[model samples]
Target: MHELAIAQSIVALAEQQAQNRHAAAIEEVELEIGVLAGVDVKALDFAMKSSVKGTLMENARIVRHDIAGEGRCGDCANVFPVNRLFENCPACGSYAVNILKGKELRMKSIVMATIGLQP
Candidate 1:
C-alpha cells in the first residue's frame, strides 16, 4: 500500500531529525492533513506500526490534524466551505470560486526524547 511507503518515508525523516539532534527515539510525529489530501488515517497508522518496527521512531505516535477545505468566491470576494468542490458558494452562489485551503499534507512537528533523559 502507498501508506506503507509513506510511513516508511515519515520514519526515515523523523529518524534523520532525531539523529541530528542526538535524540534516542522519536516520541511523536505530528501531521497536518487537509480534507482534500485524501490520506486515509487508519491505513497510515497501520503502515506506521509496521514501518517503525526497528527504526528510531519505533514508539513514535502519529498525531494527525485534519484541515477543512475552503473556497473563495471570485464574484463576491467571500470565503466558504466547499467540501464537494463542485458546489457553488453558499454565501453568494458563485461558481467562480478558487480554493483557498485543502489539498495539503505536511509534517508539523517531531518530538523526540534524548538518551538517558526523562520527562
Candidate 2:
C-alpha cells in the first residue's frame, strides 16, 4: 500500500527535524489526517509503527487527528459536511460543490529531546 511510503516519508521528516534541532530522540509526533485524504488510517498506523523501528521515533508517541470533510456549494453558497468527493450540494441539489477542508495529510507537531551537555 502507498500508506507504507507515506509512513516512511513521515519518519524521514521527523528524523530530519530531529537532526536539525540536534535532538537526542523524538518523544512525540502529531499527525493531522483528513477523511478525504484517501489514506487508510489503520494501514498508515501499522506502517508508521514498522517504519519507526530502530529510528529516533522508535519509542515516540504517535498522535493522530482525524479531520472531517466539509464542502461549500457553489450554486447555493451553502456549506455542508461531505463524506466523499464530487458530492452534490445537499441544500440546492447542485453538483457544483467546492471542497473547503478534509484533504490534508500533514505532520502537525513534533516533540524532541535535545542533547544537552552534562555538568
Error (Å) of candidate 1 at residue 65 is: 0.9
Over 1-119, each residue of candidate 2 has an lDDT whose tens digit, in order, gives: 89999999999999999999999999999999999999999999999989999999999999999999999999889999999988899898999998999999999999999878677
**Residue-level lDDT for 113 in candidate 1:** 91
Q: Give the worst 10-residue stretch by lDDT in candidate 1.
A: 81-90
**Candidate 1: residue 12 lDDT (0-100):** 87
Over 4 Å off, model 1 = 116-119
Collision count of model 1: 0
- How many residue pairs of model 2 clash at the backbone? 0
Measured by C-alpha RMSD in angstroms, how accurate is candidate 1? 2.4
TM-score of each: 0.83, 0.96
lDDT of 1 by residue, 1-118 (tens): 8778888888888899999999988999998888766777789888889899999888888899888898889999888886856669788787999888876788899999988765
How many residue pairs clash per model?
A: 0, 0
Output the TM-score of candidate 1: 0.83
